[model samples]
Target chain A: MAPDQIVFWVFAPVSVGSAVAMLFQRNAIHAALFLIVNFFTLAVFYLVLGAPFLFAVQIIVYAGAIMVLFLFVIMLLGVDREESLVERLRGQRPLAIVLGLGLAAEIFVTARASLGLARGPANFDETVNVGGNAQALSHVLFRDYFLPFEVTSILLIVAAIAAMVLAQRRERTTVEAAGEAEV
Target chain B: MKTPISYFVVLSAVLFAIGSVGVLVRKNALVIFMSVELQLNAVNLALVAFSRLHGNLNGQVLAFFSMVVAAAEVVVGLAIIVNVYRRMHTANVDDASLLRW
Candidate 1:
């Protein structure tokens, strides 16, 4: 087997295993840590795929920013207590298990069917050689995808404002209730 | 030797399945949110794999956009969770059922 295949075999299990562990973890902080492990493994996969720019983004965005946000929220809420396993909706767990298994079966069968016809990996080195991953990515992103880029900025702004508004309203209501009690 | 693309695709599918199950079975709103992020990351993996397979940059660009959207989603989702916890003193999704008659 090639070195890439060896790397894939090593990291893929680590990624999937951590993700499964994350789901089963009762403590939110522990779950978040498992997710960070999965994210780092995925970043390694990105590097193997020859997308160095994406590899960097995967680490910085998902692992750095997003995981920190998750950790911060988990800490702020102090919900690190063990989660109750009580079924919120009857039969949901059984149904989810059945569905998950069915989906996995379908995917495996499809993969098996296509395995005979799959072409060997094409040459990605040529693409990566075109002025490097970061340079090539920016050329496409800024030149061809400029509009969507701008739209994303607008969406981020709107989401930030909405979150602030929602959080502030909750605070205002609680303060008002406290003052009314004193009155 | 070259690695076939199907392996990556199958891996992505498995991750996606696990994430879906997590969303269904987990009651904690934060865990459910994390599961959703897992699902998005699975899709990103597939996109990057395809980008490599096709020897093009389009799929990577789409993945980039997806990352931006995921970031924006995190901001709003965490804020909502915080607000819910503040009101109900819990982050259980079932506990926030004010609209249920």
Candidate 2:
């Protein structure tokens, strides 16, 4: 196989397997750990795409910062693994499965249709500037995509306030749990 | 010359499907959260693949934005999950019947 195909072969299975493990693992902590693996694999994928900056950013921002937050919540909440996994599927599960299958099928169909229409790999020589850094990316992000950039900031601010509100809300009256009734 | 975009697309699609299944089958809120992250990563793969295919960095730029959004999601989602766990003492979706149907 070719080099790019080799890269895909290595990272793709890793990413997909971790994702599956993240789903089926009964332990929340274990699932989060599996997600870290998935994120690292994705970072490798970014590197292969010629976005070295994004690769580092993916690791630092996602695996480092964001996943730490997840770990913190998992430790703080002390969510029970056995009980959490045992919960029965609700009525919406069937619908969710159907929707997901439909989405996957649509993508498969599109892929089949576009089989021979694959575009050539981008020319790094023409796009590469003095240092081959993310020059074009910086230009577009600042110039053309500036509005979306600003909008994302606003969206983040909104999400922050909403999260704070959620975390701070107090329960005026605590209802006794059901399992305790047996004791 | 051997870098076919189909491999990337197939990889991403498989990952996305796994994530969707996780979201559908898992009851633990944390697992569900992780699954959603997987889906986001899958999309990132597709974007990066396109960027490589077109020889432009626009897809990479979009992927960066996606990363930012994912960071925001983790912060907000973790806080919300922690709060839910505190009140309910469990993170099971079935137990989260604040709006029971």
**Candidate 2: tens digits of C-alpha lDDT, residues B19-94:** 8888888778887888888889889889987877777778888998998898888888888888888888888878
Residue pairs clashing, model 1: none
lDDT of 2 by residue, A1-183 (tens): 867668878888888788777766778888889889998998887776677888899899989988898888888777745643243545665676677777887787787678544745546635642256466678878998999999999989988998888888674443455445656
Candidate 1 Cα misplacement greater than 4 A, ranges: A114-121, A169-183
A77-137, model 1: which lDDT tens digit per residue?
9997787888867898999988998997898789768764363345566644387888888
Q: What share of the reference contacts survives in each candidate?
A: 0.70, 0.68
Q: Least lDDT summed over 10 consecutive residues: which range in candidate 1 chain B?
A: B1-10
What candidate 2 gets wrong by more than 4 Å, as runs, is: A84-106, A115-119, A128-130, A169-183
Position A72, candidate 1: lDDT: 92
Q: What is the TM-score of chain B alone in each candidate?
A: 0.97, 0.97
TM-score of each: 0.92, 0.85
lDDT of 1 by residue, B25-99 (tens): 998999999999999999999898878777778899999999999999999999999988988999999888999
